[model samples]
Target: MPLVSVRQNWIVLLVFVALVLGIGMVVGLVAAPGTYVRELKMPDLVLPDAVSGILGLVLSVAFAIAGWRTWVIDSNSTEMRLWLATLILSWWFSPAFFIMRMPALALCIVAALFVLMVWFEFRTWRRDRPSFWLMSPSVVYIAYVAAMTAAIVAMN
Candidate 1:
């Protein structure tokens, strides 16, 4: 059962958005995207930092919407929890490499995130198809991200 009335669940969506944007801000403050990333030999197809950041924001909102949709449908469902975990992992991808300066570790984290995200997508295929498709874009973007990270790990 939902812990709160269905009408009140919009708050959770805001929370997800704030939590994600806040994490991004904190990471920005600490990492600052200066010499650390620019000096590294990036992949040929690597996205510019500005473009990647914009996509990250867009993906974050996508995740928030998917999570909100799932939570409204069934707050206690296992898929809701899985979506939450996936969202958390999504927030950590950039930080794992950019902030901590661990490309290999970040690559591993992305691999795990990719697996978890795909699992979540499959889990929602029947449970909530819209939510499934809501998250579909991230799957492709994440694969691109993982390839880019893997290349960075190789080059560095």
Candidate 2:
């Protein structure tokens, strides 16, 4: 592995960022919100589209870096794999709700992600207390979205 001197792990971090953003963009475009989304009875807490977009991008990138951090700590650790699962499921959330127009399915996916978020926080609390606290925004965002999705499911 000497020949692969692309050291400092920048390559790995870039790969994670690219993968998260790339898949996210593709899914978002493909699942571009339609009448179904507008027709749903959205929760009062829902933010404006621009605000949501900015917040979403921030959270998504934050999660990507978090995943990369896990890999850096121990690429083979179950924690890293859990982060990967969380990212993949998060990416699919839009498609499930916007593309497939299945609020119920989306709710389930989000619920699973929320559970994973809790597990992740518990795991990180021991190793990196700051990171656990840093993830508060992410946890709140997921919970807020989950609530919104549930509202949609119940409304229509």
Candidate 3:
């Protein structure tokens, strides 16, 4: 790889950003209600919902940025293949877990997904010197996933 040729692709970056924003909006619309206590009623509903929505938005954006960075920079980097696969799997699992309405199963899936994400981050960090701009989003994403998994497990 020539130093001069490693030019950043703004178009790809923008598309990735768009994907994150779009997915964030969709996830919020679909999964926002589930944040509240379902089986056991919580004392305060409004705060939970608001907090959840903000969390959702933040996670959604984080995922979007991570995906875009992965795609744009490591478009064909084999080192990133595992991370890419896990990210896609996590995304797919989300819908499946929710559609089935099985919190226990969703928890399992999310837990595994979080592990994979951690692995992905580890691999990425080791293979390349990703900037804070790239690494921060991935960290936030994993945290969000963990929080969501906890919330869902509690519901179950």
Which has the greatest TM-score? 2
Once superposed on the true structure, which residue ranges of model 3 sit more than 4 Å away at CA? 1-8, 31-37, 40-47, 92-98, 131-133, 136-156
Q: Model 1 TM-score?
A: 0.86
Instruction: For each candidate in turn, give its C-alpha RMSD to the true structure in angstroms.
Output: 3.1, 4.1, 4.4
- Which regions in candidate 1 have their CA more than 4 angstroms from the true location? 1-8
Tens digits of per-residue lDDT for model 3, 27-122: 545653453336433232224656756865675556555655566566686535655565566555455455555556766666676666666666
lDDT of 1 by residue, 1-156 (tens): 223344777788788678767886776677566678878998789877799789888987887778888888888988888887876776676677878888898899889888988998888898888788888998889888899989998898
Task: Compare candidates 1 and 3 on TM-score and give the better one.
Answer: 1
16-101 per-residue lDDT for model 2 (tens digits): 88898889889888888978777788778778989989998887777777777777777787777777778888877888898888
Report how far residue 25 has shifted in candidate 3, in Å.
2.6
Candidate 2 residue spans exceeding 4 A from truth: 1-7
Worst 10 residues of 2 by lDDT: 1-10
